[model samples]
Target chain A: MNLLRTAREMLEGTSYTLGIAGRTALALPQLWRRRRETTEQCYAASVKLIHVIVLVGAFAGMILSLQTGLALADFGQEGSIGSIVAAAMVREMGPFITAVILAAAVGSALAAELGTMKVSDEITALEVMSIDPVPFLVLPRVVALTIACPLLAIVANVVGIYGGSIVAESLLRVDPLAYRETVYDVLARPAELFPFPKDIYAGLFKATVYGFLIAVIGCSHGLRASNGALGVGEAARTAVRNSIILVLVMNFILTRVMYT
Target chain B: MSTAASDAGAAVRFESVEKQLGGKQILRGLSFEVPRGTSFVIMGPSGSGKSVTLKHIVGILAPDAGRVLVFGREPGQLSRSELASLRSRIGLLFQDGALINWMNLEDNVALPLREVQRLPEREVRPRVAEALERVHLADAAQKMPSEISGGMRKRAALARAIVSRPELLLYDEPDAGLDPATGGSINRLIRRVQRELGATGVIVTHSRSCALTVGDRIGIFEQGRMASEGTAEEMATSSDPRVRIYLGIDGEATTERSDSRGAEHGTGATGR
Candidate 1:
């Protein structure tokens, strides 16, 4: 009986979350009128997220360079570390690292804030005032994150590649100029469809999808919160957990679809 | 209210409205009518579905069975824009004030005017100031909700509710979590707003003091159903045990005194 009830609730929650996403898509037409709130949210979601992305991006690149460069050292080919780091950072690690930071920071914060508002009747207050919470509250958040995540991923890619270049020259005894040329080579290579390389486009596309999912999940869970503080805690926790899981799963699927 | 307004129709009507939450039936065939421009209070114990019924009128929740009509339009059946149009004519004061914590009192009160009416700042400023003045919170307009006391928050929420000059006002436990003195002030504010605006009021409270102080007519609810409803004088004489127990009507003398006291305040079951 408990399992059945749990399954039912899970299905209901998934459908509700999807409905929120669909509503967000439909609300795009109202974006111009609500530009001020969306701009404010953009500041909160993106400007506040830059430091975390930079720190994580740098460390992730340094680790990638050290591990892969040494492994190639056994075959006297550690010189290839530059291309490997650039490709990995652009295709997978850049979007992934940005998503991890965002899921933990912005996503959980959205859930907790909205959950508190739900418990306190603030959302209902908005509704009672004839303001739809979706267009009023959720749209700005979803749009802000969707726009910010991809741009922030570019920040992550640049910083990570530079961090990898430093590790390659200092730790692996590679020349700085040679490392730069190889890194530039990978970035310069073009894909089949677009003028840009597949790595850059794929990473950004992935970030956009991940960002949308995080905001949608966070807002959905928060809006459904009941039972007060405990329920709010659960919403925030679940939003982060679900966001991270979806990011990893989507990373693999997008890689296979775009690359293979 | 004019006789024509009364003859036109009730401001709100609940027809055999039933609702369930999490496997529990919160409202069971609840039925009532709130006359246009009268303060109608539904007094009941906790979990008696007073708040749930208020949400229905707001179109926040639809009844699983039956209907809720606001000014002759069924709220549950209205489309999103239509419901919002209906809701724009009403204002609700929640138990906890429900002020958007991030905004100052001025912006909070100014929200409906700016967001729904899209009024220009030149017009919104004075209207917001007037509402704060009406609630006697004009001095604290710049203060955040967290900076205010509980009573002040309720009053600030009242300012926000009335800034739009809504036609119907709903109060969900307007006196909860306050000392009697503060509660009395809130009760007075509700009566003042209802009378001054010529707006219909549907207040849900378990506080007998509130019911006696603000309600022109009162309904006593039990287990999601109406046990009794009448004016203060009629309720004072009601032999219904549920009404008797809930109102704490001890004897004929006490009931007479309570009714007269209620009348003196110009509201308490005066049947106005």
Candidate 2:
């Protein structure tokens, strides 16, 4: 019952603050005095994106190579390996892997930092000063997350494809030229890779939606945290749990609409 | 800052106000007027709804019943812009100071002006400097809240409170956690500001010296009501047990004196 009540309150708070954030976005020019290219913000976001892309991309690729090799060997067509790996990474694994990485890394950080600020009365101080914190704090994060995540997925796709290529050549004794040719041929097909413009669009849309969800949960939980150390930990934990769940749920819905 | 002190009007007024939290009543039918150009202290022990009353003035908490009028307009009913205007006109000093630890003292104090007004750097810089000077914290303007002493942070928070030169001021335990000397200085500064700017104040404090120095007419909170009110002089002289106890006077000594005086006068006027 207590958990249910807390969830209800968190939802209410998120919606209320999001409405305020919407209004504040309209008044951005004044609040953001130094809108002259936020290089530091973009740099920080890029570092987070790169870290996830590299780790998830390499791991997914190695698993795909090993498993696909064994499975395809039974069918007597292990030569289809490169095409299989390339297609899977671009269409399915890339977006899903990227979202999960963000949910754990960047999303959790947002919750922890904003949560600490909230518990420390920073949000209240901003309100007292007539500075609406929703826009000042949440908007930049949402924008950064949305723009960075999709780009990171593209990078993950390429890196994962390379990882599979390495295994095919080094471990599986497949000719590098043949593997490259198969990957290129499979990826070149518009239908297999793109499917529909809606597929790519849906992935991007999901990224943005995930961004919105993460920021909302992080900020709301942070702002309403209890007054000390334990409060900060709770906010971070709640943000990560809620954001990861919401991301997977959203991805499932988007996938159904795009593929099924 | 100088121009804001020029306007003269009733700073804040509460008419039959009521507040409830979690289905429990915090304030019940509170009605009062705080005239401009003086300080009025709300005296009460803990859990007396003092902070709730202050929040209503800033629209942080809305009264469930009755009207809250600030500068003659209902605070709850005001449009966002209007509410913003009213808030900018009134300065609130929270009990915890509510300083933004991320920002240095200058930025924290400059936050309101930067948000509410589109003033140039030249204009805002002087005001920030002047505000810091008023709180005797001009030296610590560039220091973060973490780097400053507790007393200095409180002073910095006070500087933030007054940066906009508000016509009305609210202090939520301004002397809380300060040493006797620092607390006394805070009281004197509050009194001095009340005189110089002629800003009406609602000070919520536990300090006896704070109430006596800052409040022209003090209200003693009790039994879900303002049980009694009078000038400091009248309250100091009152034989009421609640008043006597709060004032730290000998309860038995006052009771005996009142009894003897009542017997000598052959009346019950002083007996109660």
Model number with the top DockQ: 1
Alpha carbon lDDT at B177, candidate 1: 90
Query: What share of the reference contacts is kept in model 1?
Result: 0.93
On the 0 to 100 scale, the lDDT of residue B80 in model 1 is: 77
Q: How far in Å is the alpha carbon of B72 misplaced in model 2? A: 1.1
Q: For residues A1-260, what per-residue lDDT tens digits would candidate 2 score against the true structure?
A: 99999999877866865774575457456435534223344456667479668978988987897789778878877787888888778767877788777767777777777777777667766775567776667666666666677777778778888899888878787777887888888766544455654434555566666666665666666666775888888877877887788778877887787678
What's the TM for chain B in candidate 1? 0.89
Pairs with backbone N, CA or C atoms under 3 Å apart (clashes), candidate 2 = none
**Interface RMSD to the true structure, each candidate:** 0.7, 1.7
Q: Please tell me how candidate 2 rates in CAPRI terms.
A: acceptable
Writing each residue's lDDT as its tens digit, candidate 1 over B161-192 gives 99999989999999889886677677877777
**Each candidate: what lDDT?**
0.87, 0.73
Give the DockQ-based CAPRI class for model 1. medium
Local accuracy of candidate 2 as per-residue lDDT tens digits, B111-165: 8887677678889999999998877777778889888766677677878888888
